[model samples]
Target: MTFNHIDFYDIPHVSSALETKTNSRINNCSSSVSKFILLGFSCTRDIQILLISIFSGTYISTLIGNLCIICAVRCDLRLQTPMYILLANFSFLEMCYINATVPNILANLFSEKKTISFSGCFLQFYFFFSMGTTETFFLSVMAFDRYLAICRPLHYATIMTVQRCFRMGACCWVCGFLCFLLPVYLISQLPFCCHNTIDHFLCDPGPLIKLSCSPAPTTEMICALYNSVLIFSTFLFVTSSYTLVIRAVLRVPSAEGRKKAFSTCGSHLAVVSLFYGSIMVVYVSPTAGNPAGMQKIVTLFYSVLTPLVNPLIYSLRNKEMKEVLRKLFRTVR
Candidate 1:
């Protein structure tokens, strides 16, 4: 699809005398722009240092937080169950997702040139998409696990067997990787004429779409529909699963039993709420007059902060995760 050409350089013509002088002084300016400038958080020197420090801390914390989850899950025999196994997968995916964006962002913040090559930008987007897709599917699978555990307690063991859980996890990764391939491929086909300044910190789809010199209505529509469907269907599945879980909890004879069930599911619910809430706010909300600053804040929440939080939410609140951590600590000691 073709789009209206958007000029990046609006050079004003000078008088003949000035033009003659300028022409004499300059060589040909005909090189195709091969790199894009990423104007990340700060333009000020002090603010750049501050931003670097903050993101460095966040990146380190993200790695440690996610690694702790993986180590905890692996060390504790009790957490060898399907739920924690799923949590391990999530932690790993989160690490990859955060790594895709944060380190490069941090590097750019400190460097003299805050730019990425065209290929490098697309590669970043690829990993980001792959990890993001995997996380979405993993969350959906986790919801299903909770559904079975709460709604059909007696059959939970029978239905959510280790083999079944592994299959589900594999499917999540495969499907996510496959689903995002088309969009990435489509993006690679479009020729970027000279305008390469990406407004946001990373190569996100929305801003990239805006940069496209080619018309992208169909691509945008397809992406919008695909994203909406994935978000909606997974959300609906989670909602339905939780509804049944709540119903089953209500039917329990003792208050303690209901409380126990609620406590178990609480962390997952919190994660779902945080993730879907931020996503809806960013993508679903109207963007006509939205400021660039606000968009960056929202983008940071999902792309940067959410990954850091997921491992913490699960490890801190879930007893199985806590048990795993305790065992891991003992083993190291």
Candidate 2:
């Protein structure tokens, strides 16, 4: 999608000829332009080159990995169960999740001009967080699925039918986007006068909020509370579901059955930990007095690393997935 080309150098606040920026709301927050400079990974030329190379490879590998899972699940008849179906949905989500941040990151890394249009910034902000939220909901649903399959075996098939799984997936996508509307909308409406340069790669709420011309304590609190509720509720739900799952698995007489159950949950748990671990540090934890650099590191970890890890965690270790991927390779050759 093409956006209006605005030279970042032309940004009034960025120029040396600019008037001294003040805390005063009227003088600082009234930017008529529709762009923001994304200060993405400011480092030496050599470091930038190395980062570009690393993330380029990572991005390609992540895309290929997730796409393979989506294709394998869709093409293979035996893999059409609720678990694989949800896996495919998660794969698609990862694609979007990575795509939202990485491509712009690459573009910014390669060029000296590191700017994103205002529309693009918020679009990234909205979609990236929305995708994260969707993934959270999906994880919760997957945990519930596992809990049902392991804990209530007889009713599993009945509860998580093909139609039902699709419905749940759709609901996750819809709810994720809808839930954040108020917060994002309110944040976007805030007058950003301090400076247009976002310290992080994308339009993150914490940094974006700080650039506000005036202190908006109420808005900040509302956003924080909204995020806290979502993060804690879903996290607790997933944990609770797994607790029940562990209980059910322990009841199984055979060690083999227990091992099999754990194997399935292990991959998901790892992915969840990586995603939530980095995210909680950045978002759920105290953002009140944190340094921008710390926030940058935390955001980079989840936005770049987690998506890269997801395909490996989900697709590679599974024997059936390996077989499907091999067949796909052979067919292409």
Candidate 3:
């Protein structure tokens, strides 16, 4: 059966059939994609079940804790101040924050087919990052508030009026969301070739960029630059404020006054440390030779555990928040 003795035209039908089969697959790929598969947390079935239980408890506790903060702020007339108002806003953001990804995560835990629609993935991508950015701004806003209250106590009331605080909070949300729009747009317009699998849990930029056919260095650098700048700038602002706050507190000449000042800022500092520590490791640090599972663990820390711990951080040690919570619960009972 040597091909050298055969006429190539005699096998045109075979060639045509093979060509048709290849074309069919190509055509199938040409259709609009409605969904993507998420290969989240490579684990055995039993492990996934255990993870579901763990995440379910975490999600529920996060929800309840943040809700309690919101309720305490809303119910307590004594807490109708700028600080409490900002606290409530932050708690509300935390609720939406965890809500954006936790429920889907829980579903994927049990689902045989773990898939998310194209629109849903991008929406989760945008809102989740936007909320994180907004939180950075809010943290900076809070630091500024602390600065005013501690350094310029006499003018704090006049400078940080109720209306002004609300306006500043609104500005943070607006700017945070708007800051990443261009980068997101650029990423969205990329040609994602045949592969439609997302490697991570929540459509994070790193994993999404990896799935694209073409490398996106410029877009990635821009987004990373934005994240780094936002994180560092706000963090620096917070640090400076606390520096001045500590100096001022030291000058108070009374241990009670110094302790009081530190108490107000302790929770915020703890949260800032947790957030920046985990996020910097994931987004800003060099990853060329990083361990495989580290990113997921760091992301989980900031995204899930941070929210769950925030209310405890704020309320557990704060006499004011504790009083308000007890009163609110008593009133309900």
State the C-alpha lDDT per candidate: 0.80, 0.86, 0.86
The Cα error of candidate 3 at residue 311, in Å, is 0.6
lDDT of 1 by residue, 1-333 (tens): 999885544445545667777554432221365678887776788888888898999999999999998887777677789998898888888888888989898888878778998789888888887887787788889989988887877999999999999999999989988888888887766656557788778887777777776678787777777778877888888888888888888899999988889888888888788888877776666542256677788778878888888877877777767776877788889
Q: On residues 1-333, what C-alpha lDDT tens digit does candidate 2 reach at each position?
A: 999999976887676434343333455357653788889888999999899899899999989989999999988988899999999999989888999988998899987879888888888899999998998999999999989999999999999999999999999999999988888898899887747888888888888888787788888999889888988899899989999998889989999999988888889889888777877787778754567788888887878888888889877667788898889889989
Error of model 1, residue 326, in angstroms: 2.1
Model 3 reaches what TM-score against the true structure? 0.89
Candidate 3 structure quality by residue, lDDT tens digits, 101-199:
889898887887889988788888999999999989888899899989999999999999999999998998899899878767877876665678876
Off by over 4 Å in 2: 1-29
- State the displacement of the C-alpha of residue 185, model 2, in Å, after optimal TM-score superposition: 0.8
lDDT of 3 at 71: 93
Better structure of 2 and 3 per lDDT: 2
TM-score leader: 2
The reply for model 3, stretches above 4 Å from the true place, is 1-33, 287-289
